[model samples]
Target: MLDQTILSILKEQDQQLFDLVLREETRQHEQIRLIPSENYASPAVKAALATSFTNKYGEGYPGRRYYQGQVNTDALELMVIERAKALFGYPHANVQALSGAPANLGVYTAFLKPFEGKIMAMRLDHGGHLTHGSPVSVTGQWFEILSYGCNENDVLDYEEIRRQALEFKPDVLVCGYTAYPRLIDFEKFGEIAREVGAISLADVSHIAGLIAGGAHPSPWPHMDVVTFTTHKTLRGPRAAIILAKDADMMDRIDKAVFPGLQGGPHFNTIAAIGVALGEAASPAFKDYSHQVVANAKKLGEELKVRGHHVVSGGTENHLLLLDVRKSHKLPGKRVAVALEEVGIVLNFNTVPNASDRQKPLFPDGIRLGTPSITTRGMKETDMVRLASLIDRTINNLKTGKISEGESAWKDDDEAVTIAAAVRELATSFPTFAW
Candidate 1:
């Protein structure tokens, strides 16, 4: 458990901030958190964030530091790097990136000159993340981007992706995704990148834990560069790590992360990441990873049986996109709001082939996953019950029982009934502390 001494001190110094923190903690304990990218860090990982290392400024790599007081910082960073490399089987690891976007930007800086190279990546709506090639991101702003999309059935068309890579001959070919539920074919991606004379980069930010625990295939020995966030599924602090197979590429990435992109590394977060990597390398975490997938499969199956349109028919991993507009005649945003009123948390997402008539602010799909719930120790049977609750909530919304708008649902009788039942169920399966 976390040491409550600091929290007690904070409560005495700033009652208002302490109250807000308590309320947020209560909300987390009471809600069914289905967000795919979210998880509860273990007590050790949390404690590492509050350590004395946070006060130091570690500007460079171990043994090559620009600062004087880095003896302890260097030891912590080297442990983190070695743990990450051992877990992922990578030859080199850089643990200084603040988050996923910076890690990706570092890769670009190491390999390609600004405006002198091109990138081929998956389309955003089809499952790619914003950093991949979205026009709104710095990556798209600085480089020429060619994007490929999934087929009508919501599966990656590798043949078409290969064709695009061959035609464009981009400087880099990137794979992996944010909302994709199926296993990625990293071998094919590497083959295409090789044929086109482009570097292959796999952004396995969402599935890093699964890879570490042997629940999913790894991109190693095939991909030249890989990036992942420690917080999502990995259940660590909010930081990112980059790994590479070649020594030259590793040196380039290290320089890019230090002087090219960011300054001093956050030693506190790096220590927390080391704690998470240690946990991930354990046998227990492997069981947790397998159970996460099993719970997701059961939840998707139950939702499909209830007549919901699960994108791509079902999920093979941690998340599934529920197309509420197609089956329930309700906007995804509307359904998401109603679920939240009942203490079921998820986000509205854009499904493949979403029509322009459906506004971007209110897309046609809701993305739900089993990571957080699985972390709470819920299993397949629990997933069935939760799916039933979700079905009842949506049915009430489709009818006139729960009001159509977001705010009006709070006062409706059916919504209140559902919320009470949700609270009861949530209390039964208390979240784990460590």
Candidate 2:
């Protein structure tokens, strides 16, 4: 919880934003956040955000900043860059990019050219993200985008991926996702990219912590460039970074992040990222990462025990994608809303080859992760209870009592009762608020 003085200052300075803050705190306390892309930052990271560093305009990298007041900010930047390189085993790293999407865009700008080449990545419905070449995104509109997907058995088809790379002959090959639940074969992906004379770029934005904690394999030596958000499983502030394996790539990447894209960087966020990188290097962070995977696996098992279908049969990582159509004849969007009403938080996503009947499946599969819960000190037992809550919410949706427009789950007495029970369960595992 924030100090009373700060809360009072916020209320006096801006009542509207203060109200929103209170609402957010209430929401966090009442619900279990399972969104794979979301997590709570540590007190150190939060403090960095509210520091005077935010007031400084450090336009460029450390010593080369375009503005003054960067002496200490420069030190923080250099330290963060070094820590990131050490953590990920990269020869060089740029911690200035604002977020994952922007960091990826910087890579594209630095390594690729418009219309001169194509980029290959996994299909969006197959658990890849927008930056992975969704047609609507600038990455697709500017450069020719070729996509690969999981096989009929729901596993990444490396052979087919190689075939696509050969056919497309793209300049870059991307291996990453926003909702994928299986372990990635970075070495194999590297081999495929090399076979077709393409540079491999792995975006570990969703699983960086897992990689750092040794829960997932590192893609550094295999991929020429790697990019990721500092949040997610890393449990840091909202920022981004690009790591290059060679000095030649480093210069291009730095240029791309500066004149090619964003202006003055947010040194405060970078400072927070530095703190997080240090934290990730700790033994406790390693244990937390392992626990995240353990919790996700436990949650998936519990859901499957209750007759729910988990994509890939089970998860080996921090996140899981649920096929809502199995338990109830409902879409991902509906189940997500119902779950929200009942104090459970998650997202609806698309399964590979989800039918047009489930069109616009951005709201298709419910994507949830265990990073925050694990951070909250909840383990496998809590995961089982959370799964039960999700099951009950889905069952409630089956009753056809939940309309799309209903504002609050509490409006329905039975739903409210279930939500109360869920709240009570969450209260038992109260998150660290300081």
Candidate 3:
């Protein structure tokens, strides 16, 4: 809970702003959050982020600072670093980079010279992120990027990937994805990278918590570098961390993150990361991770039973991608918007083989996860209900049977009565804090 003094000060300074923030928080607790990339941090984590540590200007690692008066911040920093290394089994950890993209860039800056090496990563259209060498990113401008794509079975093609690695012979082999619905074989990726003499970097940003919770395999022992955001499934503040297999790489990672990339680090977020890391190490976190996967599988099963097509057939982790167009001939974007109007939240994604010819968006898929909804204490039954609501919404939209739009409801007295009933049904499953 926020202190009364601070709340009073905020009210005096900007009551409207404070009220707006409060409403947003309330909204999150009232609606299901199915986005895999989002989560609600614990009150402890939020408090740490809103603490006085935010005023500090910590420019370097603990016990070695560029600025003064960091004794407490140094302790917080060391706690965060040690907790991360212990959790992930890394020789060294850099908790300075503010987010995942910069943490990845820090790894590249430390290991490879600018414009001198090649980067082989999963194709962005397939599931890879832009920082892995999309043309629009600085990564692509600096290094030659070789991209690999999924095979016809909608799975990673290791043989083709090895062939490409031998053909391009990149200095770095990146293994990770933002929308992949299956488990990653990190050891195989390590083997392939070793065969090509390329450094293996695993961006476990999306699955960090799952890895920590034993819901997924760890890439620490098999990969040379790993990067992740502390938020998302980790349920922490918005922050980044980099783990290296070599202790000698620590200095390089630190330098690249500081003078080579960003300015003063966010000590407050680092403190929150420390708190979150400590929390994640508990037995409860393991249970949470297990539930995350179980809930995802349950949701996938429910969606499939409702006549929807789940990408990769189903999910093995926290997320599931639904090919909405294939199931109902409705665009994912349209379905997503309709669901949002009914108090559900998720994102539209691109599924394999979905083209603009079939749907205006090349890949018409709805990507959802059980992380936040699970945190809200929702189980298989809620997922079934959610999926049924989605199917109904899609069916209604496809048949042009939605008789009441928001504008129509707001203007017409009778339509407003119908809209109120719709909202009542939507509000029956109100979300609550974890």
Candidate 4:
């Protein structure tokens, strides 16, 4: 029988850890969580993670395994694969890659040789992920990598990308991004990759749920390989799935994931991913996906009207990048820390064209998204309120209403008032409503 509770046994067994978790939960419930890469796993998905499947060691695919007793594990994984294929329209699914980075490594191991093969991908500070060939990541160190980025206005011009691809003639051409606010044109990427004899690999880990929910265009029938993490907008557990256009390509990827990269699969996370996939396919999740984008658009617009520097002018998807350098002498880290003290939480990030302005550690912008708040049932109007809270906080520092220094926000009375209002608004919505 499937049975569970709200960490009741953990509370009785280890009161210390349980207390810590509850405190974090309270923080989550009371803060405006705007980080783009973050979201709350659904109750059902978390429940799946807590199931008895964690004890198994399924070291291989459904039919073939080094360890026995995979009868139930095999069924669970196969069911998840079918659900993924149905959701994303991919012909092959590898749900055992642990997370996005390994899944990407699986793709590379299948095609490119170590310290060889030219790879072209987007630049990290310009919205691309580290796995897409950042200099610090193994992907960059192991391969010959060239980078592309958004233009001065934070827009990707496909013609420029095509020109670069023609010049570089990479073995793999990568697209998809982390902080990009506009729609990804996968078809254009495919066209350029084919023209240059490069394989089109999209790490759609950020927008996979949006694509599945019809909030964004699908990469299928265009991309040869796609990698996705199940958390974020999918509201799933922390795991990844890779897809191939056909089974022939999947053979290389499968061998790479099992023999080349990982050992036994985390069946607990796999089970949770299955539950999340089920939730993502529902009508309610579809509505949630669109609302997330809608909320982001509204928030970006509201902030823009208040004279904040909204990068790219506004957003077309679930995220917005705000350049504080346009309005403040301090870097974005200061504003981000101040907001955290006031109960709103997000990350400081490099804006488009950051090299011309700030370094990576102290970038000029803050990156925020609507996935977390939208999960709490926040709408466009709520975004209006959120923007006001943000603007007021920024302006408080701008106009000398509050001082800026290390933890100075904790001592300021004006900051106290802002925190009170933020807490009220954040706690007004149920922690996990939608």
Candidate 5:
């Protein structure tokens, strides 16, 4: 929660903006917030972001910075780097990246020659991220991309992946994903990369906190370089960190992030990340991580009981993909909008085997996760209730009780009923000061 005094000051400075912020705060407090990539930052992390360090322009690494008055900034940056390395058990870490995408780009910049390098990555429709060589991204336009996808059963086929890697002979073999609900075999990826003479990069952007808390397996021994956003499951400010297994790769990554990519680092965000890393190292966060996965599993089970088609049957991680088109007989886009009306906010996503007719914007599945709700202290019991709420809302949509409109379905009686229930649940597990 923001300080009331600060709110007062902001209200005086710009009343309209302050009112909007208040509205957004109310919305956050009211909604279920099932988005996997979202989480409520702790008060300590939020305080760190509001520090005077944001005013600094530390343009280089700690010891050899390019700007004056970098002594404090250097110390802060070094603290963040050390904390990240210690937390993730990496030999080296760069905490200067603006976000996950740039951190990944830094890896490409560090090792690959422009317009010549080849990358083999998971297909986007199969749970991979855009930076993993989606044609719209710079990584795709600049490099030759060979994409692999999950098998018909919606799980990674390691043998097929290895075969593709060998045939493609890519410069880099990327693993990790955005919406994958199964445990990744980082060792298999490493073996395949080794056999094909490729660098193995694990973009654990979505699972860094789970890895830190031992809820998920670490990509340490097998991954050459790992990149992740600090904000997602890590519950920090919007920043990123890149970790490398060895000194040589670390040197190249640092050079790529600094002189080759971004200018000055966001020191305030780095400080917040350091705080988050400290929190993640605590036993309580480990318990929280475990609970996050448990809640997801329960949610998936309950959804399955409601006859929803959960991708891969259930989830090993914090996220689950629901085949809305199959389960509810409604497009994902429609269900997502309907859920939003009922205060259960999530996103439309493409399923592993989505037909060509199902466009990106109107995908066949909905992606949900327990991160934010878990952060709010919701657990397995709450998940069962949530699943019921979702089932009822979709049923209402299907029965034409909640009519769709150009705007959100706010005026519908059933949506209002579900929204009330959602508000009650959310208020019971308040995010304030957490």
Candidate 6:
């Protein structure tokens, strides 16, 4: 939350933007946000974002900056880099990539030529990110892409992955995801990349906080290069990090990020990243991370018990993908919208194609997680309650109490009752309890 003084400044300078921020804050306080990629940065992290460091521009690495007034910026960034390396157990790191996409591009530029290099990655529809060579991104347009996907049951088929790796011999083996809800076998990915002589890069944007808190396994010791965003599970600022196993790899990625992709770093964000790293290093954060997974698993279990079609059967991480088409006989967008009206917020997504042929838009699946709610100090019992609300919302939709389209479920007695229940549950905790 912004301090009163900062809110006053915002209100004075830009009333419209301030109002939007206020409305959003109110909405967050009233809704159960389940978007896996979204979380509330701690007050310290948010405060760091509003610092005077935002005024400076440090154009290069610590010692060799292109700007003159970089003493403070350099120290802050260097400290953040060291924190990242230490926390992630890596030898070298570049904390300058603007965000995850540019971070991955930095890695690509470090090793691959524009048209000649091949990147082997998980298919986008199967949980891969855009920067991992989805056809819509620059990563796919310039470079050759070989994609692997889950099996008939929406599970990763590692044997098929190995077969593809042997067949393609890609320059980079990419193993990370946006929506896959199971634990990644980083060791197996490492073996495949090593056997194929490809550089291994893991993007842990979704679970960097979990890895930091030891809820999930680290990608290092298995990956040659690793990239992650600070804002996601890490509960930091909106920036990204690239870690390399050795100096040679580090040098290439650093040069690629500095002189190749990005310009001056966001110093405020770097400072906040340091703050978040310090916070994440605490014992409480470890407990919060474990609870995040517990909540997700319990949520999946509850949903499954209610006869929901949970993708991959269940989750081992902080997220669950549901085929709403199977359960409610409704499109995921309809369910997502209807649920949001009831104060439970999540996103519609593409389930693995095994169950249905769904595209990115109007997909039949919904993706949600427990990170934000867990950060708000929610637990398994709360997840059970949420599942019940979700079931009620779906049932309401079926009976025409919940409206479709870009409309809220207002003007109905039952809808109002469910919404009141949601608000009661949502307002019970502070925005960032953990």
Candidate-wise lDDT, in order: 0.89, 0.85, 0.81, 0.89, 0.90, 0.89
Per-residue lDDT of model 3, residues 1-434, tens digit only: 34456667778899898898778866776666788989878778877888999998978777788899988998888888999999988879988888988998998888889889799998776778889998889998898899898887778988899999999998999998888889999998999999999989999889999999899999968998899988888888888899988877778888899889999889899989999899889898898888999999988998888888888889988999888877877677777776676667888887776656443353578889888877667767777766766665665554223455433122244333433544554356444344
- Please, what are the lDDT tens digits per residue for candidate 6 over residues 1-434? 66778899999999999999999999998999999999999988989989999999878888898889877887898899889889999999988888999999999999999999999998888889999998899999999999999998888888999999999999999998999999899999999999999999999999999999999999979999999998888889888989999999999999899899888988888889899999999999999999999999999999999989999999999999998887767788878988888899999888887345577887888999888999999989999889998877877765224444434332367788888999999999889886
- What TM-score fits each model? 0.96, 0.95, 0.91, 0.96, 0.96, 0.96
User: Candidate 5: where is the Cα deviation over 4 Å?
Assistant: 399-411, 432-434
Candidate 1: Cα lDDT at 29:
87
Error of 2 at 359 (Å): 1.8
Q: Residue 280 error for model 1, in Å?
A: 0.4
Cα lDDT tens digits for candidate 4, 163-249: 999999999999988889999999999999999999899988888879888999999899999998888888888989999998988
Show the lowest summed lDDT stretch of 10 residues, model 5.
399-408
Better of 2 and 3 by TM-score: 2
RMSD of 1: 2.0
Which candidate has the top score in lDDT? 5
* Residue 432 alpha-carbon offset, candidate 2, angstroms: 2.5
Displacement of residue 190 (Cα, Å) in model 2 is 1.0
State the lDDT at 235 in candidate 4.
83
State in Å the error of residue 416, model 6: 2.0
Clashes of each: 0, 1, 0, 0, 0, 0
lDDT of 5 by residue, 365-397 (tens): 999998898888988999989999998888776
The residue pairs that clash in candidate 3, if any, are none
Worst 10 residues of 6 by lDDT: 399-408
Candidate 3 TM-score to native: 0.91
- lDDT tens digits, residue span 1-434, model 1: 24588679779999999888788778888999888999888888988999999999978899998899888999999999999999999999999999999999999889989888799998888789888889999999899999888898898889988888889999999998889889888899989999999999999999898899888899988899999999988989999999998999999999999999999999999999999999999998999889889999999999999999999999888899988888887788888988998999999888887766465577888999888888888999998899999998988775224444435442478888888988887877757632
